[model samples]
Target chain A: MKRVPLSPLRAILARQLRLLRAERGWSQERLAAEAGLNRTYLSAVERSEQNISIDNLYRIAQALDVSAARLLTDL
Target chain B: MKRVPLSPLRAILARQLRLLRAERGWSQERLAAEAGLNRTYLSAVERSEQNISIDNLYRIAQALDVSAARLLTDL
Candidate 1:
């Protein structure tokens, strides 16, 4: 794996995503299905290895039953 | 110019960006320079024609001296 620099914002997003998913006891596959996203892509996002667009962010937030802004909280 | 469908979240972002820039009396070029992004790319984003990643969003938020979550509000 090519080691890539992690973005601070992405790191925040990763932590928030993981926390949210764990709270609901949903596996990444489960969340991916709910969000209509590929499991691999969702996994990558949780790892902070993907530079996801706002569209994906919105979808994930929606699937997690929250506002997109909620996921972006704490910047 | 091909018309791409606008995303609801992107529309919110565009409106917020424009409002923020206007509040500061900064032109798009000025904000782009402050954000270390291309002027044309910022312009496209303002028009809701860009699929901007979180990295770009972070940069813009930092340039505007606001939290990324602030820009994402009302979504």
Candidate 2:
């Protein structure tokens, strides 16, 4: 299957999410659990294959103990 | 038809988008054009009826000359 390229914003979000999770030393699975999201979905999100909705971003931000805005700021 | 209640985060985004647009004295149609989104879709987003994707949020932020994080921040 051909892989679709991520939009610049989505790429930024993916990097931000991975960085935040790394800063906390949390595994993707653990963060997914905290965010009430499926682990596979969260992993896909970090891969920039998902155009994650705001509510899901809020969930990840809440799990990371950061503002959703923080995840979005670099864009 | 029954209206769905906005999630708290979505509601905040709606209010923030509207506030920012109002602050710039831009009408919804104008902002939508600037953001390259359909006017009706932008209107629904402003009304908290859309769970806007991160990419679209980025477009709106770019249009408003605000950080995407700024829109997602209140959550």
Top-scoring candidate (lDDT) = 1
TM-score of chain A of each: 0.86, 0.86
Model 2 alpha-carbon drift over 4 Å, by segment: A1-6, B1-6
Residues B1-75, candidate 1: write the lDDT tens digits: 222234578888999999999999999989998888889999999998898999889889988999888888753
Q: Model 1, which residues run further than 4 Å from truth?
A: A1-6, B1-6
Candidate 2 lDDT over residue span B1-75, tens digit each: 212234467888888998899999999989988888889999999888898988788788878998787886563
The candidates' DockQ values read 0.38, 0.36
Q: What lDDT score belongs to each candidate, Candidate 1 first?
A: 0.84, 0.81
The value of fnat for model 1 is 0.56
- Candidate 1 chain A: 10-residue stretch with minimal lDDT: A1-10
Candidate 2 - CAPRI tier?
A: acceptable
**In candidate 2, which residue pairs clash?**
none
